[model samples]
Target: MFDTMTMTKVVGGLCGTFLVFLLGGWAGDIIYAGGGGHGDHAQAYVIEVASADDAGEVVEEVDFSEIMATASAADGEGLWRNCRSCHSLEPGVNSTGPSLYGIVGRTVGSEDGFNYSGALVAVADVWDADHLNGFLENPKGYAPGTAMGYNGMRKIEDRANLIAYLDSLDD
Candidate 1:
């Protein structure tokens, strides 16, 4: 039968467990307290980085063609994994985007059955390395109204490598 003593013991056990947790948290807070207001605590250690202005290093503009010439198709093949979801490497096969098999020199927005947005055609006539570079660098930026929602590959090396790989597929 449910008795007053049995209920009191059960309640006491719960209160004891709660007290243990409360005391433990209070102790931990005291032990780990930083003792400073917002943004006032000293950094554990400072990492010194050189400022571009202070370094006075001249950054020469890199030629895109030169970068493209050195691109490795093999490296680009690895990067293609990212594009695999939307585009097909096989000619005549279209996915969310058009096939990229002959993209290197193919006319923009000319993929047979794929409904390309007018954005790509408006930006460039052909998918040459240069145009591909700009497009790969920023898809939405290059073609403002294109359906290619990919944010873009940011690095020039990556864009060059991907183009080289696509070019190699058709050759």
Candidate 2:
């Protein structure tokens, strides 16, 4: 025979479990919907490239000097703040990433005495303005297995500014 107390306890436990699941789902929704951060800010949407043609591959492109002229150093400094956590501008002061002393116009993965990822070393060429822009825009895509864990900058303006800032650091 089921007693009244036993029935009440069983019902209460079931209700509690259901309530927990509901609350957890609600919290998860809130977190994801908040744009991965807790602030009101604009985000640059990514342009997906499904196919080689859809990827906007240009076989022959005309020179666009206006884009280069519009780069802003101040804006680049603003963007560099995000990188400061892993990199240092000071000479011989390496952090999570290598110290970025005179990084602009220098050979990629060629920082003396720094341990670089093989992926980065693979792209050991000059980091010209155009190359830096592309790399900053998408690190993983630029170098398949680079140790730099940053997702590329989505906004063109941000990449330009960041490149300008880096350029100014030349020795």
Candidate 3:
């Protein structure tokens, strides 16, 4: 059903297409391969990022003791909105995370009927103020391999307040 002319045209079309692709590739290499007179020399642009010390200075270090001293349970209750999705405030009711009811002074990994990662059990004995502060600052860092997916409360004030709110629940 096909003629020689048709075969020749088909071959020519494919060859043309391949030639166009090769030319395009060569053009791209010339443009992006630093062929614009910047051959093997140092980079023209330097990106300056703020040092860790500078970043640390930018964020005022919060004293958890001072914050907890005046921490309002009311403010903490509001901040609890972030934790509410993953945790429940009610005793014995575990959500995505274990219940935070009486968590302030409770032993870590001691929640009945809730499975806990061995990391938590190994690192912490009780959820004291200091331990809670550190854990709240960075859950994954405090207890590596912890199943808690929380990125952690960055602000010490917020953590203190949340702890206060949780502490208030049991009383």
Best candidate (score: TM-score):
3
lDDT by residue (tens digit), candidate 3, 98-124: 999999889989998898888998877
In candidate 1, how many Å is residue 108 off? 0.6
Per-residue lDDT for 1-171 in model 2, tens only? Answer: 789999999999999999999989888988888845668766578786598658666665524245668888888999998899999888778888988778877778777667888887666487777777777878999888888999888877788878788778765
Ten residues in sequence with the least summed lDDT for candidate 2: 58-67
The whole-model C-alpha lDDT of candidate 1 against the native structure comes to 0.88
RMSD of 2: 14.2
Estimate TM-scores for all models: 0.66, 0.60, 0.70
lDDT of 1 by residue, 1-171 (tens): 779999999999999999999998887776677423334667799988988778877778899999999999999999999999988888899999888888888988898999977877789888899988888888888889888888999888999998899999986
Q: lDDT per prediction?
A: 0.88, 0.80, 0.88
Prediction-by-prediction clash tally: 0, 0, 0
- Candidate achieving higher lDDT, 2 or 3: 3
Evaluation by TM-score, superior candidate among 1 and 2: 1
